[model samples]
Target: MKALVLAGGSGTRLRPITHTSAKQLVPVANKPVLFYGLESIAAAGIREVGIVVGHSAEEIQSAVGAGDAFGLDTTYIRQEAPLGLAHAVLVSRDFLQDEDFVMYLGDNFIVGGITGLVDEFRRARPDAGILLTRVADPSAFGVAELGTTGRVCRLEEKPEQPRSDLALVGVYLFSPAVHRAVRAIKPSQRGELEITHALQWLIDEGYEVRSTVIDGYWKDTGNVSDMLEVNRTVLESLEPAVRGSVDTASQIIGRVRIEEGARVTGSRIVGPAIVGAGTVITHSYVGPYTSIAAGCRLLDSEIEYSIVLSGSAIQGVRRVEASLIGRNVDVTPAPAVPAAHRLVLGDHSKVQISA
Candidate 1:
């Protein structure tokens, strides 16, 4: 079996950051989000993979060159536009020719991995298999309505009136029979050929369609809040280690990993946090669920539940929480002035102010 990982899209939901970087490449616990999916595919014993990339093809290729790091032989298939999920499968025809493959959305996070799902699919070999999870907001995702025998009966793409709370997770398994379905479906009202439509086609054509409702953690890290939540969830299982230098004046609490070359002095760091390599934290309070990336500096600052990217510096900031700082950015306290507010936000930016 092969894998098709979709890493292309205009990530408008994660503005400003996605404006400059690929959404799939955004780091969770100092590692790119897409890396987790690729590793899972490798673990599932899928040796050959095809990555669907768009405008950020060069960057994705640079990071995942030859797929040697992930134990898979990767082929890059270019998608000239950010079409729908079905369109991605349509474009990957040559690479996925007549092969049963798994389609993974690169920016999606599934905690337990897809090994079990892959095994299940191998056993049943259904014409189409989709993973479903109960979500609070079914309208935000493609939802599925199951039939009497627990088969998928109907599928809707972000329906206004959802029939069920079971939202489609980003992982899907399909046999070569899906090629006919993709070709038979028409573009949705949104001007794209949605995968949900293609699955519905398969069901209408009397093909077996399977659905599994996963109870494990799954998230599509498309927005900042979701990203931070996923980061915090992953940190809960952190194993503590300190390969870096911590001065006697510093206090390291539970489950924190300090990478090599990082130095901590006169500071206190709480549990389930990570200090990346070559970072320096002095006279600061690093609280739980915080990930400071490599080459960063935190001085006289207090941070918790936040992700600071590489080469960024946060100095003299009293406190920061639930924030995602981009790479190579500098954050410092403003000079003393009258009480006022200042913010230069980008598109879709969300801010909260204490009253």
Candidate 2:
């Protein structure tokens, strides 16, 4: 079996960040979210992979390259627009022809990886297999209704009145039979061909469809809170390693990883946290569940439960928590003389200011 990874879609939910960068490239634990899914697919032992890309195609292609680094020969299939998941498969037909493949959403994070699910699908050879997880808000996701025999009875895309809370997880396994299903369905009200509808088409036509209700952790890192939460969860299992310099004035505690060339001076870092390569943390209290990306600087500031992306700087800040700072961002103490607020924001940007 091969793999098809969807890295398309304009992440409107992520707003200003997605305006400049692809949502799939958003870093968690200092690694791009898309990398996690790719690593999982490589770990599943399905080498031949095809990545579906849209507006951020150049960036994604640059980061992933030929996929040699991930031990897979990848093919980049360009989607003309941000159509939808089913549209992605339709465009990737040339690469996925006549082969059973797994479709993994690039920005989704699954704790254990999909090796087991791929193995099961390969053995059973079902016409279609989907991963499902119970979600609190089924209306936000493509939901599935199961029959008495524990089979998927119906599927709906973001239904107002969901029949069940079993939301479809990003990963899906499918036989070549899905090619016909995609061609048979029409676009939903959203003007895009949803994957859920294609699955419903298969079910209505009596094609064998199966589902696995995963009990493990899974996240669609689409928004800020979800990204921060996923970062915290991944940090919880971080293996402690110090390949960088920690000065005599600094004190490191708990499961912290000070990556190579990073320097910590006169600071205290309480882990499940990471100071990325070449980053400098000085005279600060780096709290738990935080990840400072490579080439960053934090001085006389206290931060916890946040993610600071590459080349950013935080200096003389009182404290920051549960935040997502983007690349090349500079955070410093605001001038007291200018009591008034100043702002430059993009479309759909959200900001919370202290009154």
Candidate 3:
């Protein structure tokens, strides 16, 4: 079996960050989000892989060159546009050949990995298999309806009136038969050939479609909130270690991993956090669920439940929480300016001036 991972898209939700970097490359716990998916794929025993890439193809390739580090022989396939999920499959047809493959969304995070799901698919040999999870907002996802026998009966993409709360997770398994399904399906109203539509096509053609509702944690880390949530979730299982230097003035509490070359002085870092290699934290409060990336400097700053990317510096900032700071950013006190009061008052507006 092979794997097809989709790492291409205009990540509008992540804005300025995505404008400069690939969304999949965004770090969770000081590691690229896509790296976890690649590790999971390698764990699933899929050797040959094809990565679908678009505008950020070069960056993806640079980071995942040859994929040997992840134990997969990867081949890059170009998708000129971010058409849709099924369109990715269509473009990767040559690399996928007639082999059964798993389509893993690069930016999606599935906590327990896909080994079990792949094994189940191998046993069942369904024409197509989809992973589903119960979500609070079904309308935000491609919702699915199941039959009495647990087969996928129907699906609707972002329906105004959802029939079920089971939303589609980003992992999917498909046999060569899906190639025909993708070809037979038409583009949706959104002008893209959605994978949901392709699966619906398979169901209409009398092919067996399987569905599994996973209870494990899963997320599409395309937005800031989800990214931070995933970071916290991953950090929960952290192991305490201090390979770096921590001065006597510093206090490190539970489950903190201080990477080599990192230094902490006069700082109190509390549990479930990571200080990446070469990062220095001084006279600051490094709170729980925070990941400070490599080569960063945090001086007299209090940070918690946040991710600070590489080469970034936060100095003299009182507090930072639940933030996704990008690479090479500098967070410092803004230069002071003369105080003034300029107001456009409403009917009952009250103003007070300081002498």
The lDDT of each candidate is: 0.95, 0.95, 0.94
Query: What lDDT, from 0 to 1, does candidate 2 have?
Result: 0.95
Cα RMSD to the true fold for all candidates? 5.2, 5.3, 1.8
- Residue 300 of model 3, lDDT score: 88
TM-score against native, each model = 0.95, 0.95, 0.96
lDDT by residue (1-355, candidate 2, tens digit) is 9999999978888888898899999999999999999999999998999999999999999999999999999999999998889999999999999999999999999999999999999999889999999999999999999999999999999999999999999999999999999998999898999999999999999999999999999999999999999999999999999999999989999999999999999999999999899999999998999999999999999999999999999999988999999999999987779568789999999999988
Instruction: Encode model 1's per-residue lDDT on 1-355: one tens digit a residue.
Output: 9999999987899889888899999998999999999999999999999999999999999999999999999999999998799999999999999999999999999998999999999999999999999999999999999888888899999999999999999999999999999899999998899999999999999999899999999999999999999999989999899999999999999999999999999999998999999999999999999999999999999999999999999999988999999999999999888888989999998899998
Q: Write the per-residue lDDT of candidate 3 for residues 1-355, one digit (tens) a residue.
A: 9999999987999988998999999999989999999999999999999999999999999999999999989999999999999999999999999999999999999998999999999998999899999999999999999888888899999999999999999999999999998898898888899999999999999999888888999999989999999999999998789999999999999999999999999999997999999998999999999999999999989999999989999999988998999999999997899888778889987788788
After superposing candidate 3 on the true structure, give the runs of residues whose Cα lies further than 4 Å from its correct spot.
344-355
Give me the runs in candidate 1 sitting further than 4 Å from their true place: 338-355
Model 1: how far is 282 from its true place, Å? 0.7
Model 2 residue 30 CA deviation in Å: 0.7
Model 3 TM-score?
0.96
> Which pairs clash in model 3?
none
Clashes of each: 0, 0, 0
